[model samples]
Target: MTAPLHPGRFAGKVLVVTGAAQGIGRAVALQAAQEGGAVLLVDRADFLAEVVAEAGASAAGFQADLETYDGAEAAMRFAGERFGGVDILINNVGGAIRMRPFSAFEPEQIDAEIRRSLLPTLYGCHAVLPHLFARGGGTIVNVSSNATRGINRVPYSAAKGGINAITQSLAMELAERNIRVVATAPGGTEAPPRRVPRNAAGETEAEKCWMADVVRQVKQSSFMKRYGTIAEQVAPILFLASDDASYITGSVLPVAGGDLG
Candidate 1:
């Protein structure tokens, strides 16, 4: 569903949102556009066009892989050329690439997990920092996961822990320059089924049990004992990106229904 038109909380702003084809990224893009910002939605999926359309005339879409620095730089350039400069950047392009025990993961799988859950944020910040500095300052909201402390995805967890470190260090380093860096650690969120599954192959019973264990642990960890909604996840993210959170920086707000990681 489209977000309701707002009284311009982000009027005259140019925003870039990674992974904006679906889930929390899509929700943030829609809300940012609804609030009068010109939004640029980036993702590897062709369905990004749909989000652009849903976001109305104020939005554009770019298809790019954010896991690589080159891809991240290209996306940032696309935003710069189309929107002049990015006033806000939402780095929401990471997830657990697979569900399995750490001991069961091959070396390649461990590398993939870091690439999928960490590099996008790291490379995104690197690629966009110059533009933000040129503009005097901007807001960067990285989407991290509460799985930083969960099961069956230790590599993914470590990646998010790295994100927490990134948020804190960069915020301090950029404070004098007016750039604010913050993150949201979302608990398991309730959203539509993935159009493209992270792992599409059939799993063995053991693998299925492992994934179930992860889910069980997630629910058990949440104070609310339930997964959060897309809207619930987006609220804190957009707030952190907006003027209301102008005084806040270097913090990772947990939107995990009481699951603070």
Candidate 2:
């Protein structure tokens, strides 16, 4: 039930959003479609098909593991074949896969954090560039987290930091081509209950404590001292993706209730 307030903001545009099956990704895709954009919703989950159906004729779905280059390639190919070109790319495929103190993390866990929260944005951007270049210009809105500043999830923080760096560097490099690259660093957000959870079952009490600490830090760090609603997070994302942000590039806007991270 996320209706479009800025109708026609994305009219006639073709948008590609990764991680489109749920949460912020799903919200963005639906809002974009409602605003008159043709959306290509991509996710590895089969449930992505349901989101596509919900979008009706304005959107289509593709299944792909966006952490890999092959998955990124396949998604871009599908978009090109179906939509002819991409006008906006929303790299919303990352999340903190685990939350723990930096010292408590295994090396493999560190690697997984980077893979889960960073590589998709890197790979998705790389795969979609050629398509955007072909179209002569486009916009990219990367979803980063305000936890980059306050967290028990150290590895995830680093991954989102990487997102900030890439957003800055890519925006400069692509400016001449009119390809604006920007990011939104969201703090805590409230959404529908997850059909899938990030934490595994049978977590130890110690692990539970660690997760609780993360939640505490997120709220404390926000000036509002509360999590934001899904619509609050979606508004700035859509703004950056829309032509309204044509003059804005290489910037990471924080949508964290005054948490300036």
Candidate 3:
């Protein structure tokens, strides 16, 4: 869907991507870089640096635990120091911290889920707003899930619902500044086995088993036989981050392969 039309759409721009160690984050960073944008990859003290190095001069990485104040600050500093400034911020750092029947989560578990899956995106946006405003304006792409449409994924649904709201509110708030804000709701995605390691933090065995099961569940939920690949999902993101999407904002462009349709 996001073909190379102009080829130089993002030339000279600087984009910061969180959760850049792997999966959707990694793919988005590479896609942006290939389109000519400088990339600042960020993650918790690990995956970031490796991806950045692979990006060469077109990219660099920031290692931090974004759930904390100091961690977010350090990442902001890293982006500024590496790229001179940030013109685009992709809030791609979030996941199903804990999945269960929406009615089953303990209050504490819900809180943790919100902090881990939703707050980091907010913090990243806050960290980059100054740079974006100073430069007149920029674009932001927040990756969410089809669960945001109130599907049955419980905690993930709630977290993504919040992301959807934030994307809308921020889009309007930044519209006058010429900063575009949008979110993607992906479902039935193939996601492809990532080139970047899973989570890159060496998730505990229990976590690994749970995540692996999720992949199975997602496939089973779909009517179609296969899941959408990362590249297909990445298409809308590329458009949202490029000049071609300048006239679009506050749109929850779904990449869910007809799952929510």
- Winner on lDDT between 1 and 3 is 1
TM-score of each: 0.96, 0.97, 0.84
Residue pairs with clashing backbones, model 1: none
Give the per-residue lDDT of model 3 (tens digit) for 138-235.
Answer: 99899888765443346667777888888999999989998999988887555546554423456566555666666666666556645787777777
Candidate 1 on 166-198: residue-level lDDT in tens? 999999999999999999999998889888777
lDDT of each: 0.90, 0.90, 0.76
In model 3, the number of clashes is 4
Candidate 2 per-residue lDDT over residues 72-150, each given as its tens digit = 9999989999999999999998887777778889898899889989999999899999999999999999999888887
Q: Could you report the Cα RMSD, in angstroms, for every candidate shown?
A: 1.6, 1.4, 3.5
Model 1 Cα shift for residue 61 (angstroms): 0.7
Best by lDDT: 2
Please give the distance, in angstroms, between residue 67's alpha carbon in candidate 1 and its true position after superposition: 1.0
